[model samples]
Target: QWNILSDYFLCFLPEKQPVQIRENKRYESIKIVLSSSLSKVKFNFVLYLCENIFDRFLTFFQREEPLIHLLYHELNDLYRNVLLSFLKSDSVQQKSGQDLLNINFEQSALWISDKEIKIGRFDCERTRKLMSSLNFDEKKSFYQDVRKIYITIANYLKKNLLLNNMLLRDLQVLDHSSRTDQSSGDRIIRIARTIPNLLDDREIDKLENEWALYLVELVDRSWYIKDEYIDSNGNIQITHVASFLPAASQLRALRSMHRSCA
Candidate 1:
């Protein structure tokens, strides 16, 4: 089964998520190809495994009271380990100076060098700082394991030139910025710039409502789809909210994908 699953994981790309590999000192300790970089080869491979792992975890998240909280801490531990492994890889060179996982890149000073970058709603400084410093195990706050998954997705997509720009745009507009200012014309430009990067002609033609629905499908496939409930830490209560499967950003990714097709 492991062999078969490994083979299936390899199918997403002939090799792996293909992108220009920039070596990072933080990730220097590890040497496995799939474990490093966002190569599609690694993403889909993990996606296949996470699909089953999350399925086993679904029943716990749906329960009321402390069950949901216990489940989150347990899963958060798992996410942290995955993150630790990724950080030890050579790709972690970008944020060697700080605790990369906690730095929120979009909020960084470098991103706003041009306040003239008026269109995006994201906190460029915060998002960039975070993104650059972001590592795998740092997800102590969010209850959704899928957030780690999409951050993984974002990291993998980082290699494609188109994907790189799309993500930067996301940082510029939404990563740090609140959605309350939806009235600005720059919002449309912010979104529009991302549309072209998501899908090629083929993926667009293959699906309808591709972005939103696809995320539904993606989360459902890779993780246990959760219902509305309270998120927690160990026995400690966090908050009451609907924690759906997958990183919430996946919804945006799907939307980006749909925009490309449209």
Candidate 2:
């Protein structure tokens, strides 16, 4: 019964599945071209982290802002920092000159646990021997190549994965910080322009007027509601909830109207 349901539900799956499978095969083929097993492992691990870092960041949803723009910056920072830290690490001190690259891949292998779906067990002894056999020039060249790959991957992520869409950028106006900022008028206009049916010219003018009034009220109330006080230990603490955007309720009403029409 499950198989029958899957067959019916996924009838058009063939249109997309083969292309993905072919892409995966091409990626695997490229990995096969890399001569060193350690290099292959490093490449695979970096790619795995690149693909999964967003999922890791999603776990912080309860603590972090729900804005996509914020997520893009935070996730990009986390990914780049991890890769940069790995590239810059030179903890194996005893080795002199380019022999820094001669260390065992075991250090790299230790990064992942056996529970993680990684490549099979690394032969640390054989890897160490292979690395140590390389001369200074060879080691230098290999290190440069690895560094280039990491940089290229980082650039690829910035271009493809991060949210650079105009609509997403305009949506930032809904965030608490942007909502309360004096300079968010343009962003608010952009949001209204993007979702025209949701906000006509008359409503946009109304919102602008409301926003001005809202900011005035917020300033007046800040002294009472948004307050900072010194504790007994002399540590300053802020205790205030940010005000919601006035445009939010309007958008919610628009959504309700669309749903009712549907």
Candidate 3:
């Protein structure tokens, strides 16, 4: 690139301009050529050069906020990933600097992983397959690593967690607000009516079923509930069980799990 630019300069530079004479005359050079309108030319050239450099730099450095946001959104769809790959590669590129580089492949390899797929809904066989991908590393003391690809799938999953949690939370509130003896089976049926708005019917059914089981497990395990149930109007009423660990806590646990064995 330098050679090309130097050649262009040599060809276009006026002969009346001063020539540089070096100790190695065979390898002589000219100083940057100037014009009476040099400043204007230089200003324009600098602008052009800055833009050229910026174009190159942009793929390296993040610039304007809106542009970056748009780029990320567009890139996400184009790459159909969380843009973790871009982050990882940018990280690597920053560390490797100017001129020639010589590094061993094994040493250069980025060893961290980033992939997130729900372990919750997966069946026994599919879940087993996911476990197989983890390979049970002893060094990290974590049985599985969540990120396997260059891009960590955090951005994608974060939105999903928000969406799913919102939908489920709304359903829980609506169900609890109603004062009636809803049959155990029919409670799921109420959820069935609204599945399309929340998730695909099949997925919503699966998620709701698991959520019910989770609630049951929580009620069963609670010392407050097991020890404190009272007979109200000849009915054993177990009320006000403790909530599950907050989603933030769960996400943090998963993130810790991802980084631990890595």
Candidate 4:
């Protein structure tokens, strides 16, 4: 039950598959804390905070696709901003020269829209009993431990993840929205470079040239318009579809090129 959040955390893992968070040495301290007797409270509290943070953070890059437009700088910037918000929280203050500095966590951009972040389902009888058993100082110590774990997880995401794989980043060129002005042609070549044997030199050059023509076609053909209807006059009218699809087109094109040369 406590590992539910940890399971969800795996969903955020990047393509290269870094060390698993469960066995990760960086999270050793967090694991120890979770193994403690009062783990129910600690786990639930961490879960509550993490749920909110991940939900908001995901809003930046998570998308439904045939096409997933990704940029390293975009995701990296969002990750930094999320952790910075967590760090800026008064609930988890910074100790400057042994003096605790209080800067409000509520003021953090992540929590701005949330009027109050209540641990809704986690506020059960067991949790209340555990919380009530702690004295004032004990409660303070408990919260401090929880805050440390929260910050640790945030920092881990900020630093040790595997989002920088050039292949994954280069795949962004496949997105229809990213193909503007034939710019993705060079990017397609770069992607081929990232994945050895994906395309040879001549093939890469061919793909790039084809991608340029594809761009011109996407514009001329109004590829974004998928649905056509007959007007009152019986003439066909085309309407623009919202999704930037035919992202698969790039893959299909590459495959065709590969097969042609083979």
Candidate 5:
């Protein structure tokens, strides 16, 4: 049985071709052509692999570490290449082009020293100083590159379904605690009330009504807010007022109430 299985597997293997070569010159010619072709293919494959190895590194880190230090070298190379390409392709005057080309391309090495990583020194103070040292056009070009990086990160998050995960976690965590929900609702209501220009009276009223309904529902369910009472049948009942209105009906009511108050 084992021999039969081995024979079946060997049948699926690719058949090797036998090479036919002459004794002297033809043999040398075949060897040279084969070696050169294989070397070229291997070099190209390795280069491509190295270029894309760090493409997904950002998604793995998830903003927990210092993004600037992690991206500094890669971003420097990217910005330098982009700047050079732009200068080469644009129809600028020769003198201005030369000036742009002459601009010193320096990478930020502030966060690293002697092959060791330095922590706590990569703050906004050092960053502001670095930006202030740049010339006007250089500053503009750097900011353009920064914007492109931001867009790239945002697109990556969207592509990998990370944005939805983050948003869902934020919503669930915020709504997990009754105190958190109440405090957040109160803050929103206060902001709406204090800043009439920010939120009109109608909007304020609508927000307050929605918040009130949410609070009522939360209070009805949360044992911390509402006490439990034993009824005649010995079943436990929450002592808070239950929301009479369904969610959709409550929102509609709130909207109408806001319009009336306005």
Candidate 6:
């Protein structure tokens, strides 16, 4: 059944050109290609097929648990190969004396950076679902493979890319906004607020404390207020070294008020 479906679908692949004119021609073409080693398939073509066709194919076997299980192994193999190709690609390699290229450090990070946090979350959620569906041995095997892939990518980025630091900075700012000064802290807080379930209670508290500490320090600095003047519109404009600091005390008080009320 899988073989018939695979053959039928192979003909539709744009990458496999010379569009087989007859059914026999299509079968023959698919047979020839399938007979050859999977290594013979182009990396980009396989990735394209996986992204476009394989997902749709899964829908057909939704009720067939056994077939779905088998397909998981096959898809895992394809995924590994595609990931290997991506890691080996010229774009991912470090360019001599050049600034790091901005690319996702992981499948999940890519989605998150694109403002699709749910997609990033789904990467882990999907794997967890798969693990739950599998037997012990299968779960162990899958877990090991996933761990290796994550570690490899992380180590590679650590050694070859500065983008990792940038990503770290983004996390720190968003997760611990209170540790940073006013403008950046406020900006991160605003952004973080929009993303529901982006951070847990511990993270939120940590960020709030970091922010409160920063505000306390700002108050101590005395540089919070730099200059004061009246604008042409007759509005009082106070220019501070860090414009966000004035609101910091108010924010701290509000947080305290909320805590007390709670």
Q: Which 10-residue window of candidate 1 scores lowest in summed lDDT?
A: 112-121
Greater-TM-score candidate between 3 and 6: 6
- lDDT of all predictions, in order shown? 0.35, 0.48, 0.33, 0.51, 0.38, 0.41
Give per-residue CA lDDT, model 4, range 147-193, as digits (tens).
45545665565455435556556666655456674556666777667
Per-residue CA lDDT of model 3 for 109-220, tens digit only, reads 4333323322212222333343343333421222133233212333333334222232233233222222133443354445445433433556545645654554445333
For candidate 4, list the clashing residue pairs, or say none.
90-105
Best-matching candidate per TM-score? 4
Rank order (by TM-score, best first): 4, 2, 6, 5, 1, 3
Candidate 5 lDDT over residue span 5-91, tens digit each: 333333322233223333456545544544343333333323432343333453544644222212323333333333332233232
**Candidate 2 structure quality by residue, lDDT tens digits, 64-155:** 32234355345445544434333433443333222332333334542332222222225233334454655677655655555455456545
RMSD of every candidate to native, in Å, equals: 20.6, 15.1, 24.5, 14.4, 19.5, 21.3
For residue 213, give model 4's deviation from the true position in Å.
Answer: 2.1
Angstrom error of the Cα, residue 258, model 3: value is 10
Error of 6 at 77 (Å): 22
Which structure is stronger by lDDT: 5 or 6? Answer: 6
Off by over 4 Å in 3: 1-28, 32-43, 49-262
Greater lDDT among 4 and 5 belongs to 4
Residue by residue across 1-262, what tens digits does model 1's lDDT show?
5345435444433356423223543222333433333222234334444553344556555554323213323343333333333233233333321233343422323232222221111322432333334354432221133335534543542332131133333332222122234432243334444565654455433332333343334233113323343456445333433222133443454455434544
Looking at model 2, which ten-residue stretch has the lowest summed lDDT?
112-121
Roughly what TM-score does model 5 have, to 2 decimal places? 0.21
Q: Model 5 clash pairs?
A: none
TM-score of each: 0.21, 0.45, 0.17, 0.46, 0.21, 0.23
Q: State the displacement of the C-alpha of residue 120, model 3, in Å, after optimal TM-score superposition.
A: 56
TM-score of 2: 0.45
- Candidate 3 pairs with clashing backbones: 84-151, 85-151, 113-147, 114-147, 114-148, 115-147, 140-261
